[model samples]
Target: MKERFRLWSRAQDASPPRIAAAKAPRAAAISSASRRPALPRGVRIYAVGDIHGCVDALDALLIRIANDVKSSPIRNWRIVTLGDYLDRGPSSREVVERLIKLNELNCLIALKGNHDVWLDTFIANPETFREWEPWGASATLVSYGLDLVSLGAPDRCAALAAEFARVLPREHADFLRNLRNHYVCGDYLFVHAGLRPRVALRDQKEADLIGIRQDFLRHNGAFEKFVIHGHTPVEAPDVHKHRINIDTGAYATNRLTCLVLEGAARRFLFSDTPLPD
Candidate 1:
């Protein structure tokens, strides 16, 4: 299947005229020299930012992505989610389930975010709850039908872990455990957080992949691949020559963003409008 995707990506390189012909006048102004990095020829990617447990936004965003793809009809497509699939919002459990379902389609690539790791850590040792709760573990506990008070009790670490083990869906556990730190597709690298500056991609410290902030963000140097990441929240997608940040703080701002990439063109689909319950 991956080989098929590669072949398809290569075919897209030959049809620049078709792609250009479809571009709007405003987009046509994008000079060839200034064009954003291109994906492999036939491959298209829809990369979503930190979900932060906003299942409603996630659901709506998936609809928007589906509609966008349906209307545009791109083959060899893949969906890359920049993680933080749990916490902060009202439906962490549901968000995990939704991603699990999406992964079943065989095209979804999920990365691990710090919040996700925190959840796992808290589950194994509820003593971490003191810090985790304030970081948005309360909503995750509530979504799991667990009592925040009970789980947060000073002496209940073992009990909490046991309880969670009994009820946590195997599927969700598998999904979380199997998540990657980063994904490289064509010329873009998808990660939950930023990468360390001056380090080879292979030599990167794993912690920085989902935790680094100031250092990575401050560096203006170019990376081998255009890094697309989302550990840091932003009011809007930060598009730069070397990287793109799409985390729009969905848990609080109600905006879940998806960055779409086809050849060298980039666009976005956002779910900010509230969906009626």
Candidate 2:
């Protein structure tokens, strides 16, 4: 399995077509009555949306980010991935491996997404494979060298789970276990999914942090901090007065998004040309 992963990684290392960066139209003009939300001086953030196991797209975006930094350098910067790094795509194991490698260099802050949580649960309780199957869990299993044709039976779930646990690298398990629920920096709150409206940051539940949808999406009121998140897929990066959604549904659309924030300004980098808004 390890040798297979290495070969896959090498194959993915071939250069992909260059991605472009575009400035998002400003969401709103700053009013004299209220201060614009800004990161602390010298800090810039590159927050990536749900990966969903698209390793090739992930590779392109990371290269674009590195190029962006070279062209416009900042001493204090971060790459925060708004997680969903598993399932729904063919390269789930490779995706985790790539992130784990980046993390070792201290260049990434990976948050937990709903699909990622499913992986943890599946590991502990193989019975949950029944629940995860519809959400591309089979793709993930295949990524780890599992032959679904042989293990696809409902009765084989436990055997499949045991095989997965045995084949999964210890480091990969450690990476998933240690992923953060959310990360706060200056005025922006980074989460996998949107936070629950009206709930204090300290009081927000993990369930809501990874899964809340309509309540977080429909709220027009300001959050405790301006939020940057991904879970729900948007055709484009949905920029509102209060938050930004960057998930472009990589697995299906092959378009991944990276929301670049510096001071109060916002722009985007894409793994492929963004679909028409």
| Backbone clashes in model 2 | 0
Model 1: CA > 4 A from native: 1-35, 150-155, 273-277
lDDT of each: 0.78, 0.82
The TM-score of candidate 2 is 0.89
Question: Cα RMSDs of all predictions?
Answer: 9.2, 5.2
Per-residue lDDT for 163-256 in model 2, tens only?
8888989998889889899999888899988988988999999999999999999998888888889989877788887888888888887778
Residue 121's lDDT within candidate 2 is 89
**TM-score list, all predictions:** 0.84, 0.89
State the lDDT of candidate 1 residue by residue for 153-192, as single tens digits.
4457667767877888888888898899999988789999
Candidate 1 positional error at 202, Å? 0.5
